[model samples]
Target: MQPDDIDWNIINILRESHQNNNSLARELGISEGTVRQRIKKLKEVGILKIRASINPDVLENQQLATIAINIGESSQLEAKAKEIAQLPGVLNVSITSGRYDLFVELLTFSNKGLVKFLTQELSTIQGITSTESFLMLKSYNRYV
Candidate 1:
């Protein structure tokens, strides 16, 4: 659904305070049910998605890795990316241009887990010709 001024206001208010629907109602001078209805509508029409954010460094043994994959068949890029996207720890998968056919970002909570994900899981997928992995040393900023 296209967002109007009220929808934008409601979205901003929720971004500032995600848990307080009543507070949003107060701020917007509307009923709590109205806030709930609008948010429901937003979600129903694929306008908004809510997720909790985590810092990988704060979690013990948790780390982020990006994998660049070169596929033999360009026609199978989307199918291959979809298969990779279904794997455990996958955060995002994208079909891209240039030398790489697909880029995948995933989180691993242990050294062995990363190894298994790369060697055991990734190796099982067909059409992948070569792979390069980059593990993040540190994360400074994240913007949504």
Candidate 2:
């Protein structure tokens, strides 16, 4: 189904409660079968994901950081960024239109782990001129 055709109310229900499909159906005035089918469809189309959203910091042995990297040459930017994106602890990487060449978000087990990623792993990659890291102080209103 197209984006316009899908009922976002189902997603709202999903965000509120995952286990109670019947409750969602009752609240939305749809059948359980319909909810399941729509959810399945959404998943298939990459529009909706239903899973446990965890706070990485609260979980033992998890670390999260945002790293900004500057590249010397503009031409080699995409290639170098792709190479860095493959490294462990990298959750998501983006090549943005900004002063920084690249932005990388990471999650790891410890400070040492992240240090290894920044120092040994990323530093060794060609075209990397400078690096800046920002440790998250607090995350607010993050919705799944």
Candidate 3:
């Protein structure tokens, strides 16, 4: 679906603040019903999602890491990524172009948890040629 000017405005406003339909309508100079309908349509088309976000660094015992993975065969890239995404602690899996075929973001309990995920969970997946993990020590303005 093509997002028109009003839709883009709504998205921009939503990014700044997830206000109620009445407030959004007031700010955008539109009716509350219009705001509700637009928001519903945007969500239905996968263009918008409203959810709470928290910084992982503030969470106790939680550690964030990114793993660069090389798939043995190009044909298996998508399948392997899908499989990996279902694993525990995997926050996101992206197919990319570079030295690695996929980049996986993980949120483990601690350093030991990260180790376990690498050695136990990730290692069990076939077609994964190699992986390089980068554990995030500190982050600024990072929320997921």
Leading candidate by lDDT: 3
Over 1-144, each residue of candidate 3 has an lDDT whose tens digit, in order, gives 989988898999888767899998999899999999999999999999988777889899989999999999999999999999999989899999979999999989989999999999999999888999999999998877
Q: Report the candidate with higher lDDT, 1 versus 2.
A: 1
TM-score of 1: 0.85
Query: Which residue pairs of candidate 2 clash?
Result: none
Clashing pairs in 3: none
What does the lDDT come to for candidate 3? 0.93
| TM per prediction | 0.85, 0.73, 0.91
Q: lDDT by residue for model 2 over 4-82, one digit each (tens)?
A: 4335888876677675768878887879898788888888999887777667745666677889988899998889888
Local accuracy of candidate 1 as per-residue lDDT tens digits, 1-144: 699887899888766656677888898898989889898999899888777777787778887888999999988988999999999899999999898888999899777878999988988998899999888878876421
Task: Show how many residue pairs clash in every candidate, following the order shown.
Answer: 0, 0, 0
Candidate 2 stretches greater than 4 Å from native = 72-85, 123-126, 141-144
How do the candidates rank by TM-score, highest first? Answer: 3, 1, 2
Using TM-score as the measure, which candidate wins? 3
